[model samples]
Target: MKTFSAKAEEVEHDWYVVDAEGKALGRLASEIAFRLRGKHKPEYTPHVDTGDYIVVVNAEKIGVTGNKEKDKMYHRHTGYIGSLKSVPLGKLRETHPERIIETAVKGMLPKNTLGRNMYKKMKVFVGPEHTHQAQQPKTLDI
Candidate 1:
């Protein structure tokens, strides 16, 4: 049996839509990350970008279990002295719902260049309207 190592040109990508309403944030992210990396495909290759484009809708309604909304912290630094900033999940959700999902999904991906390319394939929108309907994205249940 020949071991499969897929090349970029041979990788076929698809578009998928995921409704985030009432979905657990972490679980949703993990699944999306998996699909984004093409791990669900038989021809998956670790070093190539074999992921699909994921369009996430209803991001504002994504749920967090327990007291995570109040206790969860998102931190960022500006590469300056004492430039750290932190925000609670509740505040982030209100101000930037797409960012909440983006951050979660990004954290689930590999921390490397390939991960960055896969991250670009992910698109998150606050409401139900998305601009990628022309691609006929299949509805994904997560």
Candidate 2:
């Protein structure tokens, strides 16, 4: 018996589409994260980029339980002093709904170069329509 390690050139990437309408925010993010990391595949290799492209549609319709829309806050800071700023989920959704899913999935992925590479393959759309129809991505149920 021998252990198999996947190589970058040997890995195959596929495109998948997921509808976020009526789906729990956290659950959807986790599933997308898994697919992005290729953890569900048999040839998953931690050091290689084995993930597939995931197109997330209807990002504006994603759901969050309780009062998260108001309670959840996104924060950022400038290099200077007293430059911290925060935005609530509700405000963020109104301004950039796509960012909600992007931030969630980003938090679930590894904080490194490989993670950023995989994250680039994840496409998010505010509406049901996407521009990747040419890729013929299969529907991914979550």
Candidate 3:
């Protein structure tokens, strides 16, 4: 039998919604990342984007275990000397909650263009509502 390799046009993508309410940040992110990479599907191909779209809502409600909420720090820098900045996880959840899930899922994906393409399919929202109703996404509990 010939080896099966999925084609780009043959990939069927679906939209899924994940509620981050009271869910652990790492676990939730990993689950979504797996789906985003299509790892859960039997026909997943490494070189192709066989993933589904993900919509994460209520991201601010995601939680951390132990001291991660306080000890964890997110770092960023501007293209200038001594322009680095950092923020604790707690503050980040309050000010930029959507990034909590986004950063986590991004880290779990491949660090390349393929990853970027998959990352773009992940929609994150701070509240419980999203505008992707037209796609009729199915809700997934992480």
The TM-score of predicted model 3 comes to 0.97
What is candidate 2's CA lDDT for residue 112? 99
Candidate 3 ranges beyond 4 A from true positions = none
Candidate 3 lDDT over 1-142, as tens digits, reads 9788899899999999999998988899999999999989988999999999999999989888999988999999998999999999999988999998899999999999999999999999989999999999998877
lDDT (Cα, tens digit) per residue for candidate 1, span 6-107: 999989899999999999999999999999999999888999998899999999999999999999999999999999999999999889989999999999
Clashing pairs in 2: none
- lDDT rank order: 2, 1, 3
TM-scores of the candidates are 0.97, 0.98, 0.97
Q: State which candidate, 1 or 2, has the greater TM-score.
A: 2
lDDT preference between candidates 1 and 3, better one: 1
RMSD of each: 0.8, 0.7, 0.8
Q: How accurate is candidate 1 locally (lDDT)?
A: 0.95
